[model samples]
Target: MTAAGLPMEIRAEGLPTRVRIHEVGARDGLQNEQTVVPTEVKAEFIHRLADAGLPTVEATSFVHPKWVPQLADAERLFPLLGDLDPHRLPVLVPNERGLDRALALGARRIAVFASATESFAKANLNRTVDEALAMFAPVVARAKDAKVHVRGYLSMCFGDPWEGPVPLAQTVRVCRELLELGCDELSLGDTIGVATPGHVQHLLASLNEAGVPSSRLGVHFHDTYGQALANTLAALQHGVTTVDASAGGLGGCPYAKSATGNLATEDLVWMLHGLGIETGVDLDRLVATSVWMAEALGRPSPSRTLRALSHKE
Candidate 1:
């Protein structure tokens, strides 16, 4: 039975026996929140997520404060995470400057954000696709020299809000470049939540053709059209094991109007457990953490798993 108490489907033949759920609740989820969650609260949230058995938690972004004021306390918050395994805490660094800050703060794992479409690249990073990659090239190189693990996030892999249905080849080219630039892993993001299962397959196929291995890739999906889990299943069947999820469905693209919150960690855990795949996450503890965070945000969590589990008598 699933966490929703629904009957489970037959086991997927090609899916990996275990999947790594990269918890992005602290960074991606909270960046778009209107409320400026205190540095202490953000630290507590990440600690709780780690306590729930999420080994890979995206801690915070070192981006400029003017753009994402919600996460302005990255400098302060990074130190508070001293107890966490540094290898497990990946922070987002937009450019060399951000990378410098992260390195200075002793961040051993960092992520750089790029885009598949010209419009999204321009909108999010204030640069064209190549220009953004150029900016990330040195950042990735420096992080590599520092012996830090670097993750590259390629957003708008399926469709862009401004330019619909991005070409699979275009996304693949960016993936290859980021890999060449020394990213240990590439996270393909459906930034606007427009990816379906077919789109996910096509994108993965194209990346494979570009010499990008499924082992070096992860999928990040938004649930706006309710296809996040289905798209994730497609990736899983394709042999992609790492997935990016936010706790309590607490995220949205601040720049893209069409983008919604990411696939909820609780919901994803529920489905993965039902599928007999190991994620090492405690569902009840994860839900309780999200519910506690929801109260901090002064709103209920959007996760169906959290909602259903919370209502149990």
Candidate 2:
């Protein structure tokens, strides 16, 4: 949306003074690295992110060690990050067992995922979409009973690797069931990051038509084709406020061969701040932290902002 005379970049949605950044670096970023980040380093990285005033950071995933060995220390990582305030540490629980382990380790917030495409479900979770959701239903129910907040992920929202473009109605129905089944919020994931502005606009429009309001939705995009930012603009124009981003553009799905890293935190914040949109995040500190994590893992950051900002005199 072009403002009256703002260079046709993006118009202000006049959103609230701030938006929450759900940092997925620790888990999402490191999980794909072949190098195992020592437990202390992982803990320290998480601590630094919290210290940077990033209100919510996804500490790590509690999936089985065999599935993602890097996050195998999910239990150890939690206590090591023990000093972090409790209200913001959201961990991903792959199933009931994952939730149980996370709860025992004192996680107050947890997340689970569902596939919008059947082939994605089969390949990722080894179950049909219904089977996967059925598996998650009890987990959500129990989490609600325990006063633990649950966030849901709906992967392949606009399109999928296996099934090609997904029906917008199917996306709406799954999202509605997730919210009705007790998810506090739903993140629409573009697994392969192939979503275009038209795809985003069409999906949101269809969702609104189906009585699915924008308030319940968050956007999770990959930068595979470098369309994440533009697609985000579409979501914002349509009134979807919350966004999920990973620091340094860290993390990609091992299963999706085409899945690139997530939208970079530094870059996203830069664009938002340029538009006078409040992300309540310090761009410098975030860039520093991304560099730290990248350094710890001995890899270069994927964030263009960090690269440019770090070289500032």
Candidate 3:
């Protein structure tokens, strides 16, 4: 490892030795862009992420173009990823139609997005909380029948814009429903990133009490309030291993105006490596990839690690 990229390793007790990073740069990161990223560029970005050893890279979402125009080329892009392992390339499917599009393209893994609050459900999905789950019911069943791996994303796990801090029971109830709906995994999202370490530990404990094991849960935190890393550490201490991050910190909820970018993969990797956790990622290559992407987006990366390391380069 290059000196610029390597962190001094100090193993932490009671933490998992290895972590699986669920990379979301290609899909979640670019979904909110006002200008569409070319299909070929998006494909190369995914390839680079895979080359950098991201275990699972979410490729694209199959939502209607009118809603997320940037990802409207999902059909065109999924085919270009044939050389990569299908299991490592999960796509987002908002409904049955999206599922059909993904399955037809031979996607072995898929995910559904849900909200913990009714206000977010209404804003993002145009349905009530129950109504949205009703929509995902058949979608999850059909995906399972097809033998596809499914992940459920529960947003506002901590707080919301229209609504205040979400109750633990409300988040737990929705998480249970999604798991019951046959979601193979659930990612708990701190949409506006208002969570502290205590709140994170409490939520994970509450979910464990509700019978949702930490093994089945993943943490997806935004850096809006600069709490993403601290919350992630809290989750790690509680035995949650899967973490969702975007390259270069390049995503936010289009519907949640106050929400900022995601927890940058480079930043997360720095922390994980410093704690002596194995992610099988080449931080040097990952930083290079994010730098290339930042240039493509015509902006500087928001990741502090990416910036500091790239400066050394």
Candidate 4:
């Protein structure tokens, strides 16, 4: 985009002036790693992300260690992030027990993961779609009583591997149930990265017609089909301001083999900056952070923008 690898600013019409990036590199990115990253390294990685001007960084998940062994050190890792604002650091909780763990660590913001399809619910959580929501009901209720901010993540909004082409009505129903269960925000995930721009627009419009405003929605897209950015732009056009991205494109669904890496934060920032949309991220610092983490992980990053910009350095 530039000789120095920065994009030239040109504001786009009908787009939000500022966007909130929900950085997920620390939790979602490392959860699928075969080898466990040191708790100290995880702490430093989160600190670096915060230093790079990420306003809301998802720190870690409180699921059972048996399920996600990589984050077995949630207790150790969360305490080390004491330097960060609790409000800006969100952690994922699978249920009441997970919520207890996070609340014990003074987590002010938390999230619950749900599925829009029955197959994924069975595969990921070993529960039916409604059963999973029923389990989350008490968790959400308790978290709300604790005065904690809650985010509900609805996966497979676009398509599901087991159930091809998830119905729009089905996704909207789960989204509404999540909200009724008292989630402060909902992140619609294109889990397998099969979403196109038009599909994204249609889903957002459907949600709006269902009484779910764009202000409460966020988009999480994977780059498996290379449509992450395009789908993101469509969400922006529909007035959705929050977006979920992993730094250096580092995460995928552990249960779904078809799902690939998430939409890279650097790539998202590049497009947003080019469109003159503010995300408050320092591009240089973010690139450096990703490079550092890549070396720590013993591999190169999967992000095209990370690769392109880091090559210049």
Output the lDDT of residue 39, model 2: 91
Give all candidates' CA lDDT scores.
0.92, 0.85, 0.95, 0.95
Clashes of each: 0, 0, 0, 0
Which pairs clash (backbone N, Cα, C closer than 3 Å) in model 4? none
**Error in Å for residue 214 of model 1:** 0.6
Task: Report the error of model 4 at residue 239, Å.
Answer: 0.3
Residues 226-262 of candidate 2 have per-residue lDDT tens digits of 9988998788878887888898999888778889999
How do the residues 15-74 of candidate 4 rate in per-residue lDDT, one tens digit apiece? 999999999989989998989999999999999999999999999999999999998899
Order of the predicted models by lDDT, top scorer first: 4, 3, 1, 2
Give the per-residue lDDT digits (tens) of candidate 3, residues 1-313. 4674588999989899999999999998999887999999999999999999999999999999999999999989999999999999999999999999999999999999999999999999999999999999999999999999999999999999998999999999999999999999999999988888899999999999999999999999999889999999989999999999999999999999999999999999999999999999999899999999999999999999999999883
lDDT of 1 by residue, 1-313 (tens): 2445542655668889999999999999999988799999999999999999998999999999999999899999999999999999999999889998999989999999999999999899999999999899899999999999999999999999888998888888889999999999999999989889998998898888879999999999999999999999999999999999999999989989988899999999988988889899988789889999999999999899889888876
Sorted by TM-score, highest first, which candidate order results? 3, 4, 1, 2
Residue 287, candidate 3: how far off, in angstroms? 0.4
Task: List candidate 2 stretches off by more than 4 Å.
Answer: 1-17
Q: Choose 1 or 3, whichever is better by TM-score.
A: 3
What is the alpha-carbon lDDT for the whole of candidate 3? 0.95
lDDT of prediction 4: 0.95
- Model 2: lDDT of residue 280: 72
Better of 2 and 3 by TM-score: 3
Candidate 4 global Cα RMSD: 1.1
Tell me how many residue pairs clash in candidate 2: 0
